[model samples]
Target: MMLRVTDQTMTMSAQRSLAASQARLAAAQAAASSGQRIGRPSDDPVGAGESLRVRAQIAAASQHQRNIDDGTAWLTTLDSALGSATGFLRQVRDLAVQGGNGSLNQNGRDALATQIDSLRKDLLGAANTRYLGRNIFAGSSDAPAAFTDGAPPTYSGTPGDTVQRRISPEQTVRVDGDGAAVFGTGADSVFGILDAISADLRNGVDPTGRLQALDAAMNRVVAGRVDAGARLSGLQRAGTENMTERNALEQRRSGIEDLDLGKAVLDLQVQQTNYQAALAITAKVLQPSLTDFLR
Candidate 1:
């Protein structure tokens, strides 16, 4: 039996073909205008998923960079306080040496003792240094100062607790120094050491023997500063690594989601031509009859 070809069948087929061509051309135009291959998840599900993952990584890297900046500020403040404390201790040591001189009379010793007391107060001030209203040496404690004022200053910081900042996914750094460890506590503290030297000087007693204690205190301050310097160096290195990671993540995201403008423009032109050709062919194939023209 011979199969009859209907005009209705041909018209439906042509319509479907033209619709597909128009859809492709619209997609190409969107890609060219938006400059993004994956406008939505439906465009490329796998690439969209990968792009989301890369974007999450970029957000985390940005947060870590902020942490690095805050940590650097805290450490910088702590280091500066330690530096000041070291200088104060050095001056105290020099005064102690002068007070130990055999030729120095009572009046001379009294003057040296007064200077030592003044320096002790300055050192106390350094110990109580704050950054953004937070005590940098207080080890996470919300104390107003690292040490309390008294006959022998006591450590106000919480023991075994410290302030820390996460600079990366796997690494964290201590941003606050330990006041008790660096400045000692009670009678064993640098304040107490200064007090003793001042008392010995006022009593006509040589303070050269206490030089050992003063030297030990200065050493602790130096060590604290060294640790701060090391942490600062590590933060600098982490910042560099973070920048490199951000650049790589951006490139990955571009590969997953972004389109090459030149390629997209070319594709749009090709799709436009194909759609125009399809329309011409469909018009020729689906010619209207006299009955259709009357309707």
Candidate 2:
């Protein structure tokens, strides 16, 4: 049997159609105004999840960039200190050569020794260099100075441990150099070597024999500077990579969440037109009066 159609049934159907059309129009207006494809998870659950993931990646990339910057500063400071120490050592080598001269009398030797001692003090200052109130040469040590004041300066840094910074999820870089490795510990330290040479010169003895040791110390400082330079280069590269990754992540997020303003505006206009048409049609269909009901 066919279902009977009544005015009440027709009115209810028209009302439901208009309400659905109004809801679509409201959604289009919201998308246009907000300029986002996914305003809430309910809008597009998969896209929202992807947007969240991309946002998290962007945050991590930002943090990694910060780490790269900090690590660069630390390595730059260390390289500068090592460079200064290398110069000081070179001067010390020259002074040692002058003291080793046979024609140089005791007074001359004493003068050379005094100059060498001054250079040694300068070298010690370089070894104890600090950046941001922390010792660069000291390996994860909280000490104020890397080497203590004494005849033969002692290394105050942690032996095996080093200060490191994580620049990426898979990569970490050591920012601080090993004090003991760069400048030997106890009597074998660069300061100690200088002390021994100074003593030999004051005693009117040849320090040419210790030239090999001085050369070794100079080499160590140079090597440390080279290592710092390498690390700085790596960090610079990582910083660039992190920036690129952030840009890519942002694009991915935009694709997932951001709406095209022009398209959204067009869609809003279309929905508004459709909803108005639906209202007009509904109004015509539901235009029955009480007289018709009485009939």
**In each prediction, how many residue pairs overlap at the backbone (N, C-alpha, C within less than 3 A)?**
0, 0
User: Which candidate should be chosen as best, given lDDT against the real structure?
Assistant: 1
What's model 1's lDDT at 281?
90
Give a tens-digit lDDT track for model 1, residues 67-123.
999999998898899999999999999999999899999999999999999999999
By TM-score, the best candidate is 1
- CA lDDT, every prediction? 0.92, 0.91
Q: What lDDT tens digits, residue by residue, belong to model 2 across residues 152-263?
A: 9888988888898999999999999888999999999889999999999999899999999999989998998999999999999999998999999888888888899989
Model 1 bad stretches (over 4 Å): none
Q: By TM-score, how accurate is candidate 2?
A: 0.90
Question: What's the TM-score of every candidate structure?
Answer: 0.92, 0.90
